[model samples]
Target: MLTLWCPSAASMESAKHAPVSPVLPSYEQEQHLHAFHACEQRHEAMARLLVVVWDEPGRCDLRAMTHVVTAHLRRHDTYHSWFEERGGAIVRHVLTDPTVIQMEPRTLGEVRAEDWQRHVMATPHPFAWDCFRFGILQHDRGFTCFASIDHLHADATVIAFLMAEIRSAYRAVLDGEGPLQLGPPGSYLDYCASQRQRAAAMTLADPEVKRWIAFLHRNGGRMPSFALPLGVLEDRYHAEYVHLDILDDAVMDAFESACHAAGARAIGGLLACAALTERGLAGRSRYSVVTPTTTRRSPKAFRTTGWCVGVVPIDFDVQQRAFPELALTAQRNFDERLSLAEVPIELVLELAAGLPTVGSVATGGVMLSFMDVNVPPLSAHIAREWHQANGRVYINQGIAAQVAIWLFRTPRGLSLTAAYPANETARASMHRYVKAFAGACRQAAEALMPTYSDAGREQ
Candidate 1:
């Protein structure tokens, strides 16, 4: 049976007083602590957006959020990757005194959506090592918990887990429930321990390890000639933000169903569309792309999050593959690499750190991520403007790749967002590419339906 770390009711009740262990950096992180510092130096503004919505304005309490966040930080030390400025290194230290900023409530119409996104992207977390900041965005109707974090220490999963914990603590406080305790716990420290154990048990000569090295080489190979060459690294402007694009529930659900019929995940159909869109620009069916995946296993791992993400590099030739076939091909590529998910990316880069490879960020300028999660501890009684909108918030610092594409499933459905350097790629061209991506996804999904399958069989 699969192991899960869920706590029973009694254990949960007693967990409030449970003592937590001291936090430390993961084994992989300890090995590359200096690299994390270097990354911080390169991108001074590395924070991403995190917004929490609440329904009842009067009932919303910033104090509750503060108590929960501070307490939660102590419970999970991975949340704190404080960079020691004096020593010029990263160290884990749960801040006993974390600054919680509170702002008066404002109206959602205070700024346009694009401007809001731009503002968030430009604002980095004040303390470089601490990673995240907490504040209250007071609105006329309700309040939003506005948080920002350093990408160096956390991923979306980390962000999700943190939010969930904070929400739980906040609820407990509001209900006079007491300090929320985590039961049947699996912390980031545990993840680090597991990774070190796994790494120790394996060797580079192992088939899977060799496959990863080769995969890195494939990504490190020559970059594809895009319809438009991505902006050079030295250019004054690297990338510009494009308006968010969305696919509502009906379209997203239909697309998902289509993918299922073809024995593929939504990602397969997405990759198929992306390749076709590239074909529009390059007039070539051969292409390579990168997809980021989480390595967390079991409910315990999900209970606590950290920088536990890995990437899969895929190369495909769509020159003769039809939409459904291309989708399946993409699915197969992802499945093959799933076995290597547990291998730390740092290990792969260490093996081929400076070697020439297409996977080099400069050579391959495209990156993609897919997310569909609800902020578990977050729900407002009242529906606000953000609630009505079907779009997902997206921000990229151009640290990973020059062109970034993200698809997220919101309450309404799936939303697609794209970004590219304004200097190299025209806004007009980016718009066309985004639409083409949407169109390709729709066409592929339709082609995968059983009716389409029957028609092909009849032929």
Candidate 2:
């Protein structure tokens, strides 16, 4: 059974009286809401995961953590209204008493292998309507936390930002400072209204529509599906974050050199690797990669804080060309899609629905996957600080599919995280997949560099 940690009467009353404020509509927020509404129309739900990390025994402080979270909530105008609008969707409750647990901690690896499993299995979801719940678990050494956020509210990027903010607030409390104040901007509801107005004004040009129609007709008008390999299903879902260091010098020289030589951009190089991986694993020649775009294209929609984000579908052909050529092709398609990004993903999904569904052989009974690349304004310094302070961070953990590859550019290089169900394949296989992906990226870069002749002249 699920649990409802109802606020006290006074707390409830205070929440009711909380001032409503405006917020800016971020491109991400609007697109997310559009997708949510689209999925809701089909009676489907969005599921996400949040992982939190805590300090070793001497460092763990549940009371301090809670205080920080509450204070963070109080100071941020966006959160105040966000919670208020949802009738305070966020909850605070203890699973196990902190007084009984020691603050001194242990290593994260050991804690993850033991304490995390025990707590999650024992605790129920916190809210009845909550797509997921969060838990704070104490271990003999350190602590770890988990949350399953519903997809309707926001995507992973927003959740990550919120967790970082919570950690910062907690640290501030520890330092005897007040919580961080987030000024008012706009509301999500307003963003939705704005989206409708903008969408109405725009119509696909006959030529553009014809292009899409022609592409669909040529390709049999069906989207390909990605099936998770059956071998991986036995392992529980696990998340790991890995970084691909592209130093500033490398970024300016090697990265750009590789991209330009391949006729691809930074993002294109990454997508090309994804496309290659899909072909290698599934033995499919054609596939689609879903990339997200912020919906803050309209100045009016800026500052509105609802779920304004959309996913653009870029189809790639793996069969006809070399990986480098495919990379450039993917890049061209990606750029074209970006130009038309203002169209909400919901509308695109709706458009796709109009076409006939042509089923393909399922390598593992899954189809339709996405590779999300988020380069938001949030920095790694903040992410690391939050993870060190809190046991976990909230990220958009989309539903389990063949795989979801998340690449975030950091000061060190590129941070690559892959979330897949353990039951789907062996650890060795997954590891190989990651390696292949990395190798492909390197090869694509190398292919993009200018070749020199024996005379030392550029070819």
TM accuracy, model 2: 0.59
lDDT of 1 by residue, 25-72 (tens): 554455335543444677633313343322324435645665565565
**Model 2 per-residue lDDT tens digits across residues 1-459:** 111112234543444444433432333443334444444465643333344334433344656765654443333223333221144123222112112211221223334445554433332221222223343445556544444344434444455555555556656677777755544445555565566666555444434444444444444443323323435442223333233432232332455467677788777767777778767776768757556656555433333323556655578677857766776888898888774555653344344454554222111222222222223334555555444554334344333333455665543345566555544244445566677666666555454344422232111
lDDT of 1: 0.56
Model 2, runs deviating above 4 Å: 1-47, 54-64, 74-148, 182-186, 199-220, 227-257, 260-263, 277-287, 294-307, 316-325, 339-341, 349-376, 383-403, 408-435, 445-459
TM-scores for all predictions: 0.73, 0.59
**Highest lDDT, which number?**
1
